[model samples]
Target: MSPKLDRIGSVHLTMRQVARATQNFSPSMKLGEGGFGTVYKAQLQDGQMVAIKRASKENFDSLRSEFRSEIELLAKIEHRNLVKLLGYVDKGNERLIITEYVPNGTLREHLDGIHGNYLDFSQRLEISIDIAHGLTYLHSYAGNARFCSAFGKCSNGEAMDLVDPQMREDVDEKIFKKMLNLSFQCAAPTRADRPEMQAVGEQLWAIRMKYLQLGREE
Candidate 1:
């Protein structure tokens, strides 16, 4: 284990303990499954709920490396919006990462899935601001941060298209546009061209405040 990993306050769980907590990876306990592996909702003996990610065996070496990288990266960073790594289990070919359970589900699910209409316009704007803050922290403090414009185009229509349909009608166009502009600036073609994360966070906060003010007026 690297010194960084050792320094992390996370507890290391044995494979048997993880299996028992997850009921031997029961399908009913599964929270989600992705390219990395399946995540299960587990309850520890101490009554703490956690999410455990178990790596698939297909690409053992590659997955192991990714697991180690994730541990190292997560250990160095701490943010309210980011998931907290609780621990990991590495026994033979099995690799599992344990993290704090997020009860409300993922942002993607809220924006595009069955929970689409659940969040109000103000809530959505606040979420956007929170994401920007998280990104800012990563860019400003995390050495491995990279700019990835995965959100979409910054054009008025294109940006609006990316917003959850339920939020579109109630969203403040002016604030939305400003948020898009900040996103565009952060995603500038070159690293040097991109605005610093602190600037992005400030801009996003300002947009959020404008949104809140508009809500009060209406």
Candidate 2:
């Protein structure tokens, strides 16, 4: 059974428990590796699957400080779109953080067409809105604001040319235009040209409603 993650809080996890869950840190169970550590797929004794990042001990002080920073930030966040911290293990040379497992892989993987198929327009729009909302929450409440954009060619009215050819038929060109147009508007070179945050939200809502209607039609 899947772990009831929503009800769980960050708890103490023993090295043995994590080691066992990760099948002795088997390479086959590894999901990915990043700056913090190698992430392995772990199944707890309670049948909950989670990602365990085993911090590298090579540079103890540096990695340990980063590990603590990560834990501090993730522990305070409780958003559906963000990964939730389940537990941590910090003892001796072992330092680890276990988070809720997300099996779908990264957005870059999907965008690169590594996943089965390219995402359609509606899916892309929904994803954009979800990311915006998540970032908005982080900026407003998490005390760490970070954002980026790539809207030069997009706002040039060539957004349709950027659509993945594989899923071109699945995409609604008009909606794609609206999405990219709003992206450019939000990222207007001059602050005066940019719409207010509230207006951006309202525009996204209208686009979302249109996407729903399009989905129902097809």
Which candidate has the highest TM-score of all?
1
Looking at model 2, residue 199 earns an lDDT score of 96
Which digits, one per residue and each the tens of the lDDT, describe model 1 over residues 101-129? 99887777887757657777899999999
Residue 90 C-alpha lDDT in model 2? 67
Badly placed stretches (over 4 Å) of model 1 are: 1-9, 112-117, 139-141, 144-218
Clashes of 1: 0
Clashing pairs in 1: none
Model 2, 82-179: lDDT tens digits are 77787777677877878889989878888878988898889999999999988877654543311121344565666677787887367787988898
Q: How many backbone clashes are present in model 2?
A: 0
TM-score of each: 0.57, 0.55
Which 10-residue window in model 2 sums to the lowest lDDT?
Answer: 143-152
RMSD of 1: 17.8
> lDDT of candidate 2 vs native?
0.75
